[model samples]
Target: MEFSLPDDNNNLSLTRFESMLKTNNVLFFDSNEFENIIYHYLENGKISLAKKAIKLGLEQHPTSTNLRLFKTEILIIENKLEDADKLLENLHDLEPMNEEIYIQKANVLSKRDDHESAVQTLLIALDLAEVDEGIADLYALIGMEYLFLDQFENAQHYFKKCLEIDNEDYSALYNVIYCYDFLNDNQEAIVFLNDYLNGNPYCEVAWHQLGCQYVIVEDFDKALVAFDFAIISDDTFVGAYLEKGKVLEKKKRYNEAIDNYKITLALDDPTSFALLRIGKCHEKLGNDDLAVQNYYKTVHEDPLLDKGWIAITKFYNKKKNFQKALFYINKAINIDGDNVVYWKLYAQINHRLNFIEEAERGYKKALDLGNYELSTWLARADILIALGEYEASILNLIQTAEFYPETAEIEFRLAGLHFTLHESSKGHYHLKNALLLNTDYQYILEELFPNILKKPSVQQQILNAGKTEN
Candidate 1:
């Protein structure tokens, strides 16, 4: 009932010389020529020739998408973007019910920076495209496109329509939930999520997301309720118990979190995340030996788990066993070979143990990987300040100030560095900036400022600013 042409490689005159078109003068030549001419022009850098060929060609087959699409590309290459867009618009009008026409038109609109119109056009095509697999893929494609554009409402509507026909469509469900989260409509998400879970109760991922939503909203009891239903629906769902353990930990129910983690470990694939939580619970309960055991279990189960090594290293670090901390951190580096967070932790521990060159190398590796967030830089500055790399520490703090601008904490550190260098004017400037932001900021007010106060009158000077601040 439908017919289209094969993609012939050569030009029309060349194809006429070929065997297939030898005696088929009636064959619709324009249909197969668009891709060839466009590619030929692009590959050969014959832009003007390509434009001329595509222009005269499409006039003969204006309704042929294959030809119109070719002319559109040629117009784009020629920097006549509006003309290219008008061609797609004309094609859509000529083939208003054609799903491919809608898709092509949407693509042109997207290139023209008209995302809202593109989404509306695709929304209309969604109903038309639902019956055909080609159309369904197109709808899914545009749904995801709108999601990338952060058009949450359109993304949700299109994805929901996609699922109306294909219930098991994973992209639709994933995008719809993403849209809900993006739009901060989690409360609204709950009503329909309950519907998704009713028939598809076995979807552990969906249940976990629902539980997290409840946790984010501070509804711990509901989070526990959701997790309980998740495990009942699928006992082997590792993420459900692991995330439930996190929620329980947030509620300070450390013992109960441990139990949930234990059940998760009983499953076939004991997750490193679960094992790490078990270690943390034991550590919190003051069972260092048990904590160490679970930490090792996590590392052995998945050596690539940086959290596992960090847990063990942190336990030893807190106990002041620097040697053991160093050992475990080294093991972590071997596992997550290029991971900067591991390297940063390793650097901090090395600095604690007075291994200067090793610490420098570790810090350098972390910084080189573009992992120098404010916290990482601040910690690095602490190590530098210890080594009397005074200028380096100050510079690191300055970089950190970029990320934490107008924050009193960073200003206080800047003041500390300037004071240490005996530049009181610069130090006072930063200290004053710190007070302007938060006059009562603990470290700045209590520790740093007290040592620099010329007289007891400075406390009143700062308190007066806090009067109008909050």
Candidate 2:
């Protein structure tokens, strides 16, 4: 809803228009003046005012093409596309060469999910366009239609053409880079950005994009240089400072990273992302107090950001303060209960605190949230076994085997649980599979089923598997 205020000329016209409205005076205005007034209302998101202006303008100048076009635009905005399209068709018959008419037609086609037709209509508009700016706009519109088709290559080509026509079109530049990223061609992006920077050396956006490309290619040295050039081009560029800090962090220069992150804090309001990165840098430097303070600030700035809470929880967990870790992780879960990582952390913290039932529930929630990691499955199954829910443990292991059939860990755990339940045939069957997968993982028997390992038949089977492997 944010928009620019009316300039002095427009302000005079707006004041006159409003005064006329209040006094119920049918004041006269030129078609151009009415257009400016309607545009001002539209720009400020006063759609009803704009519609009223259009009605009044057309009443005074019923043959005004621009006013009628504005009416068509409003109809389109209201999703009365059929009315808009009919109006556009009539307008096209009146002025066949009007680029705006073709553009509006393209808009209607796009809204109807007919993107191919939209692209063709935009091409027609491009042909009618006389000015460089209008041609660039049509190119951008065609690029957008290609994006809706998921044709990144075609989108990239058209967006590149738009950027070539207007080097200052940052959105087109972004779309070109996005297509490159989707295609995983960082090298091409790097080369293209470099060539662009040759002519536009002071363009901060291009430099930032080049830096990002270097980061993707793992060329930290070049990335740092590119970001530094971006900062030189625009000292107020917060993104450059952030990317520079990340590269420094990768190089283990934590002090430099903290300094760069702090610069971002000074340039703008304390962003949660900046605060979080600062905390991580502090933690790396062993400034535990400062790290915890910034972490608190991060969550205070943006309570919905789970990373801040997770950072504090992990910081406490690393210090073996399970109570504090559990406290913070609970806050994180309350903020985003569906996050798989949060639930996994909750399970771990609860398990560490011997809150067995809560740990089991947390693990189950994690699984329900689609955390299919082998470790998550094993931890949940182990908790079930400890709680004497042998059947549940077996069921969990069986499901885990589906996701990771080749893992010796799942087979061995299944063997151990079956043997504990006195299901000797099933236990032996799984044990044989586990040995065939990896005889080196026999230590699982020592840890989880020491009694089963002591059986003469199991020992003889292991010896025979080892000999067969030799």
Candidate 3:
């Protein structure tokens, strides 16, 4: 009833079955043909047609276990678990050695969240399974059951067992790595992968996994070597190239990283990640033209790539082109209006362009979207102060200080705000605390509070703090 369609020849069978159905001669199909027709419909997600096929198949072959099993599977899909269980139990009594019945029963138990019972049932299926045909699949199912139970070590053991049976089981191998990651046992993963590589030296996936583990442990040198081996094992491995680029980028080898990223472009279609990295490397190397070119290409390739827009906006901001930066950041916000980072960037650009009201509104939007950065709060406070809302600015700085209690800049700003509002005592108190936190922060007083710093009392207090620090 549930047969694997391993090759394109199954398409021919499906076509012929469709022809029969169109001619209204589906009744002529034998049990195997009818099962194939039912499976074809189910595989294509045509459940109604599959149900009709199953009914016709049962009418034609009244005692067919395969057709009955297919009906039970349909029942399970319909959430008729009780009926499915009863039918599977009857099938088990009729054919005690049939592995599919046990697998089906395990499926029912799994759906019911009885994973332990499911594992036991799968074990029974394993015991009766033919060695060459279904053993690997059984091992995989047991591994999944253990994963469902959050028993990562047991899952890893069974997945490893699957790999031993078929060395090409990439899914099982990846699951083993996932288990290691869940346990935070990268060293054990390294050791196991080293052993795996000893026997399977040319497996690109194993080498890639080994490289990832090395990266996790911050062993970039070993990671580079592993990624090199992955590329050597499969010359067209785009993942190896991309990961190698990342490690080289981490080491500040920008040119080498670009080379690896370029190799991925040659091996496959360009990805936003690779293009963005290449753009960043160019930006780091001071190749502004090339950086802008790649950034444009990145957004063109993926209009929704927020980072691409961000990179372009930051580039323009660095060049003191506030208008251009605002343009690109607005495009980014249009694509994803709720992104906190985009809103923050928009606020900063508006602040640079002297649009105080828009800047304040942008800052509020960013904070509402969960941007709690100290710099964001400080920028908003600056805007409030510029608007002569001293009390509102003080409230903003106080909220920021609550989050970053030890930051001298916030205290200095708060001191300046209190001085502006004629709260002399509070101003002196915050100034003393700011000097206690960072004595040299007085150097920014002219920039932050030029008018207040000119007062003799404030100047004398700063001078006194400087003498105390000395």
Candidate 4:
């Protein structure tokens, strides 16, 4: 039971209600007007005010089913499922043919995580609902319940049914495509969307979904065609323009990608993603000044956009301006302190600047934040080795070896560490395994342990290992 105040007098009623509240006058609203006031408070999340309104409404019209249903909705929202269920059961007995009672019951069941029962209850509501009264919303609710249960096929079926009932149900249409994608049935989605487009060729959303499917299958050419049609159908569709730009970027059509990204800016307010993408395309095309300008605009438009900050950081790093890189990366870390990628970049920048201790701390923070990249581990170990912490470096490398079990590079690094620690037997054993795994990594021995490479015993061990391999 959605309450809607008459549009013509709605403002007057609201003004009168506010005036009554200010003056502490008795709120003498009719039942429908009270319902509207209560729903306005509820929709605004002012639960206390909504409760007051409900109390007043029930006092004035104790038999109002709509006020009772609103109370049940509040109970469900507050997670008082047992109370909501009892109220809804009574409402069902009182108004046996009321569609909203079933809908409210379904909502309570959904909050209780009994989504299958929720769907069944909503089906009852569907039967009770008139053809023109919330049928599309009922279908959408059933589809959402099925989605909650991970029954993608059933969800897709109900969402498609919703689309059939209301052609303007774009959310349901998108959900149907989402369910198909979740089931890895892109072919079926593409076929169904194509048929839909035959009847509704100007639907930008359908063309966008088709283009996305083509991209999933790595058919960039077909994706381009679909996106072009999407743009032609609706030139002001910012999403279509942005997606077309992405496909062009993937195909290395930098100038074309830039043009599409520019179009998105022209059609709507500049998005962080669009600004960053434009910067990347310009950078690819050697328009360095333009790239920097757009990258600056990206972070300016949305200060919390971590990708924009990261792009600027990488741009400066590529130019060997470590100071500027560090500045931008720190800004990113400030916004998203737990981001492992930002910590990794921070560590790399500090390492380049010879701030060994700071770099080590940054690496540790990155590892703590779940950075399992092979390079991150290797870099951390290298930093420890540079700081003359042979024992710590060996422990770090050993931990890394657990993640990358059969890597010759790790074995070679371990060999160097052991030899540096004067553990000759452990060094010899690791050297043997290293050469056996990959003899080419023998070159790393000199780079990591220059003194040990000149030792005749080490040279003989390497030669012997090579001979054994032959």
* Best by the lDDT measure: 2
Put down candidate 1 lDDT per residue, 304-421, tens digits, no spaces.
8777888888899899999999898888887777988788888888888888867877887898788867667766766676677878878888878787789777777777778778
| Model 4 worst lDDT run, 10 consecutive residues | 1-10
lDDT comparing candidate 2 with the true structure: 0.91
**For residues 133-213, could you state the per-residue lDDT of candidate 3 as single tens digits?**
888899999999999999999999999999999988999999999999999999999999999999999999999999999
Models 1 onward score TM values of 0.59, 0.91, 0.83, 0.91
Clashes in model 3: which pairs? none
- What's the lDDT for residue 389 in model 4? 91
- In the range 254-371, model 4's lDDT, one tens digit per residue, is 9999899999888898899999999999999889899999999999999888889889999999999999999999988988899888999999999999999999989989999999
C-alpha lDDT of residue 42 in model 4 = 79
Task: Look at candidate 4 and tell me the lDDT of residue 252.
Answer: 97
Give lDDT per model, in order: 0.75, 0.91, 0.90, 0.89
Q: Which pairs in model 1 have colliding backbones?
A: none
